[model samples]
Target: MTTGIAARIADRIRHSGPVSVAAFMTEAMFDPREGYYATKNPIGAGEDFITAPSVSQMFGELIGLWCAQVWMDMGQPARFHLVELGPGTGQMMSDMVRAGRAVPGFLDAARITLIEASAALKMVQGRTLTPMGVEALWLDRLEDVPDGPAIIVGNEFLDCLAVRQAVKQDGHWHERMVGLDDDEDFTFVMGPRLGMDADLVPARLQDAPDGTLVEFRPGDRQLVDVLGRRFSDHPGRALFIDYGPAQSEPGDTFQALRGHEKTDPLAAPGTADLTARVDFEQLGALARAGGLDVDGPVEQGRWLKSLGLEMRAAALIRSAPEKKSVIARQVMRLTEPDQMGELFKVMTFSTPGLPKAPGFAPEA
Candidate 1:
């Protein structure tokens, strides 16, 4: 099926010129009109992808418990923002709030704010969170949230942010762009080589092999910088969990997803979900430079196990004996080394004086 967005992009190319991968992604995922998230729920078994929060109640509950600890660490701030970026259907927020009830004053002190761009998802989030007595204020961007001691959570959020890819051609780095072929199909084309900027190419990949693609996420960096600055100015911390390499590497991790499987990114512009891997190393560095204390980019499995996910599962199973196998499966999906445990990573940043967040302690 030919998508209107595909034709629209083609028209853009015919009028102007080839667009960067970042540009294509920006419009494809967030155009506000016929964009992927703007149109579809895009989560769960029927959607393009599934995030950690969607996997089980345990993920959200644990995150909530973590936030409660963070709140206490921040001296039990009288009023603080409990923010979640890209809060799909508000499952995480709801779970976190529910779990926060275990901690004294955590629930009462939290002012829920969800930074979600999609209106459709926002409606879903409203329905999901409202029942939990959460009066969540929705905003499109992080900057929109008023400043305060905020406990920020972003699960599977960074990967969707637009990223620019620089491809090496003839031993020089040129920006990669999306252009059309004779059949009007989209294909990658190289633009002008980069100028001499020490920061442009990471020192490790300066002599990268020809045709190698290295992605740079300016948007993600900027957001992290903003969050760091917020933490510096106000007193807060932010946690991020996503699938990506813990260290910087040279490769193109951009791809498209449709119906929970890989699809041609160029095949359907607005119909498929487009994403690139999160570069945790880069994000961590930016957060540190922006003035927040950085934490582990540890493997998700290890981190969760440290947080007692096994015990949490066991408790849930004990509560409902018949659901023991189901609960066990959820635990395995979240923490098994061969599953999300190894692929996904967890990291965080906070005000300088704050103690380390739970479940991310350094080795004893």
Candidate 2:
């Protein structure tokens, strides 16, 4: 079935010509009337894809412990914001709250804030968190979260932010735009070449071969700036975990998924989950430029292991011996080098005076 959003996007392209990839993505994913996220639950058995939190409670619990430690590192502020970006179904937040409560005043001092754009997910989150006795306020953007001493966590969130793709041609870079193919389907077309002084292309990739595709997320950089400024202005810490490269690399990672399978990105707008790999290197640089102390863009496996994922799994397995194998599989899925462990990465930033977060070491 042709989704209404697909028709809407076609009409837009016909009227205004090709749109930037970022523009297309923003509409495809967040369009209020018929966007993918706006209309349905995009995670779980029959959904688009599943995240770590959906795979196991252990993931969120460890994050909770990490937050509690960060809270202690910050001297246990009397009132602090514990904000989560794109909290899907509120499962992770619920798990985090349960685990963090063990840290004496952690939960008592926390004011939970969730940054989510989907009204659909908000309803699901309400149902999931309310029964867990967790109270939270929601905002459509990160900036809306009242700022103070805060601990912000974003898991599998940054990749969803719209990213601009540029293709190198004749030794110069041109912006990639979404246009209609001969079949009247969405396709990537080259736009104007960027100026020599354009800040969009990373310096190292400027000399890339002709036809090289590079993707950058201006929105993600802006988000880092916002979060970094928040931490710099008011002491806080932020953690971002997502699947992407540790350093800037040349390749096209934009993709669409439906029913956990890859789909043609332009085939059916607003019906598939669209995303691109996040560049942690760019994000780290942005955070540093914004005056926050940056930490490792470490592999998720190493970071999680450092945070004691194995230990947590064992403790849980001991409690439910019969479920040992099941729990072990979940841990493996999260930390196995061949799985999410290597594919996903973890990075963090904190206020100048704050110490490095639990899973991160001092930068050399």
Candidate 3:
């Protein structure tokens, strides 16, 4: 018996020729009835996969401090938007808010906003955040965020945005699509040639050898455009921490995770989490083109260390000496080169003229 999402997708593919990978992903991940996020909480232990914020409280606390510092750099706006995109379980924001207490007036000055589409997750977030004595405004889209100076934070969020993949064939790029196979199961198929525009394939991989697969997220570009316009009208800074290469490269990184194990992305739609590697270089370029200042796509481990991850861990251990081993393991998992440390990266974008964000080097 096919899953609800799988059956729906099969029907669509049967009626239409083929759907772009991005379209397939969007439907699988966002379909109201059975989409992954729509039906379940997919973060934390025993979930599909664990995010950094779930790994330890330190991650969220450090991020909170970073935002507080940025708020100070913004000259302490009387009332500025402190927005979080795709706040998973509200753990990061909770930790951030807790840490923000370190800086007087930071919490008072913050107008907390969470941009989330999943109603189920929103309920979960409500439970997580409500007890902290912090009231938050929840919206379904970024455009709905009220106009004002803002500091946006997204952790492990960008990877969830759908991406379209193209394969180089005979020196031309063909859009990779999801189509029903002979058995009516989902499968990858090559679609129409991109011709002149090359379907917006990044220049860096335009001339890649035949058979190279390049992925691009139109959503990312659109998101940057929206943020750029928002920042242009007001002052804002945004931080995105995710796993992706610091430089753009051509490859197929589309994948799925279920119960912390890698699974076939096209096997069962809407039942597993689907994601692709973020292209930080391309993202930075888009932000720059949108007239925003971009900061390092620094390794997450280095960025966290620069923000004093070790110091924070030590403090936490000193407070709970009995949990020293557990705390040490969390730090190693978060910052060790072979672990999440090197694979994940941190980047910031701000309206031009603001001081550089914390942990990032001064502009040359």
Off by over 4 Å in 1: 196-198
Global fold similarity of model 3 (TM-score): 0.98
lDDT of 2: 0.88
Q: Candidate 3 on 1-364: residue-level lDDT in tens?
A: 2788888778888898889989989988999888998998999887889999889999999999999999999999999999999999999999999999999999999999999988889999999998999899999999999899999999999999999999989888899999988877789999999776484788687789999999989999999999999999999999999999988899899999999999999988888999999999889988998999999899899999999999999999999999999999999999999999999999999999999889997421
Clashes of each: 0, 0, 0
Better of 2 and 3 by lDDT: 3
Clashing pairs in 2: none
- Cα displacement (angstroms), candidate 3, residue 304, comes to 0.6
lDDT of 2 at 53: 95
For residues 1-364, write the lDDT of model 2, one tens digit per residue.
Answer: 2888778878888998988889989999998978888888898877889999999998999999999999999999999999999999899999999899889999999999999888999999999999889889999988888868999999999999998989988878888899888988888898888675247776667688998999888887788778777876788988999999888999989999999999898778888899999888888888888888888799898888888899999999899999999999998999898989998999888899788789887431
TM values, all candidates: 0.96, 0.97, 0.98
Name the lDDT value of residue 161 in candidate 2: 93
Query: Runs in model 3 with CA error above 4 Å?
Result: 196-199, 362-364
Kindly provide the TM-score of model 1 when superposed on the true structure, using C-alpha atoms: 0.96
Residue 36, model 3: Cα distance from true site in angstroms: 0.7
* Per-residue lDDT value at 343 in model 1: 82
Ranking by lDDT: 3, 2, 1
Better of 1 and 3 by TM-score: 3
